[model samples]
Target: MTSSPTRQRGSKELWLDAAYEMLVSDGIDAVKVMALAKKLNQSRTGFYWFFADLNALHIAMIQRWENQNTQNLVDRCKADATNICTGLFNLMDCWLDPSLFDARLDLAIRNWARVDADLEARLSAADRVRIEAVAGMFRHHGFCDEQAQVRGLTVIYTQIGYISMQVAETRQDRLARVPHYVELFSGINPSPHEVARFLARHV
Candidate 1:
């Protein structure tokens, strides 16, 4: 998202985008004022206008990751769904769509958190909040407390594992199995109608 050749006035967001790209593409160490400015084709001083220091920029990136990756899943769980299958499918949308949930950024954060105790703490808290939200979805659909909790853990961990493993699979294959996955995770087989609608969205 960074522009070329010159500084764009009011490029705070451009700097953020450049930093985010660097963090995921390289690592946290790559997110320097000089590096970001070079990425944005702006002077190094431009970064200071938007952030006090690299720490401030780091905080901004973490907040974006939390808001986009964690909050989106929670909101999806709370979205309107006519049945358990449909509800679970709503959460699954994140796995299929990068914009809905950024797997790269999530993995990048997990890697970053390993070395940073404070960030690791935040990451842990975010995981709990996410699990609780998914559990709440099951509860809303009449699952027993234990069932809701276990299923929520299963659902969340399954995704985490997939991202961690960096498992490679084609979109077509994943789409074909969506219904089965929904049934397995939701404990309720989705109707053809529901499956078709969900598939239409991804396709």
Candidate 2:
């Protein structure tokens, strides 16, 4: 009898994981079938079993990023918390934690969208969802619709700027600024407990 395939040799998740790493580390241009196959230490032909083509692989990578970084973050914010500020703090954790956020992947995808019209449209849709999620967090705290929307935009836009600019700041510097940004976004200073929890997760 023929032996079954080895887990290390090939799997959809393995391919997507390798592609994600490449896209984050080397940019989208480097996430090719042969490149991934080489990284995974498998034959390029094995890729066809999991993905139809390169485009399909790229699509899968986008979905993977969306599910992990976007949907997961929003869901965590929606988790049971004491109040809206706590929920917002949960969301901010995504930015502070590299494993949860993947800012490099986000930057790479935004760069890809610059040249790909389809990706641009998809990214625009995602931004709408993300902005609405942020607005919901504000509304939960009794903010008016307009105020919530404006605050939501401010938080997300500030995060995008921080990521895209690749700002160089020490971890201590960023930790010190967290409470200020939290207050700016929510219009209330976070409690000592909240700040401690947030810092504990990051620092």
Candidate 3:
């Protein structure tokens, strides 16, 4: 009979995936090395092979957020010349999607940063990157630089408000109203065809 893989054989990717799973499901407090090891059916030594400590894993999670989520949105907007508004709308959609948004993990990081100045600074830098990228996309879509900055701020604030309201309302209720808010902010009603054509150039 073939032998099953052992904990000692676990790879770095395996550990990272396990960490992410725990983060999404249970929050930062549950991201202990022992908890991860138990989740993965591995030993503490297995975790040590990939991360020096729980803090290292937390840092990796933050870095992954920056690369996978943040960079992807920024790049998507940067790539398309016509779909700036569509892309921004799509971003808000994705952010509110329960399958996509890890509320527990996000809250944990934000709360942790309250006690760590360095982490607060790092997170602030990350927020600036997202803000600037959104502003650039607005400018590309025909708004002047100053106008784009204001629009971008509007988009960001609207998204923040949506997230805050989500706690008190159902996701379906919030999503149903997104278009109205979007229309009020964007002003021009570009057809879906225009957005598709715009996005096609980047693809």
Candidate 3 overall Cα lDDT vs. reference? Answer: 0.66
lDDT of each: 0.89, 0.84, 0.66
Tens-digit lDDT string for candidate 3 (1-203): 64345546487888888877776666666778888788878888878877888778878888876676567657655664445557566555445543444444455556666777977887677667767877887777788988888877787666555444546766566555555665666776657665454344333
- Which stretch of 10 consecutive residues in model 2 shows the poorest summed lDDT? 1-10
lDDT of 3 at 22: 72
TM-score of each: 0.94, 0.90, 0.76
lDDT of 1 by residue, 82-167 (tens): 88999988998999988889999999999999889999999999999999999999999999999999999998898899989988
Error of 1 at 146 (Å): 0.5
lDDT of 2: 0.84
Model 3 regions more than 4 Å off: 1-9, 87-93, 96-105, 168-176, 192-203
Tens digits of lDDT, candidate 2, 1-203: 65457643588888888998888788888989988988888888788889999999989988977887788667766777687678888887887787777888888889889888999998888888888888888888788999999998998889889878988898889888888888888878889999898888886
Better of 1 and 3 by TM-score: 1
Which candidate leads the pack in lDDT? Answer: 1
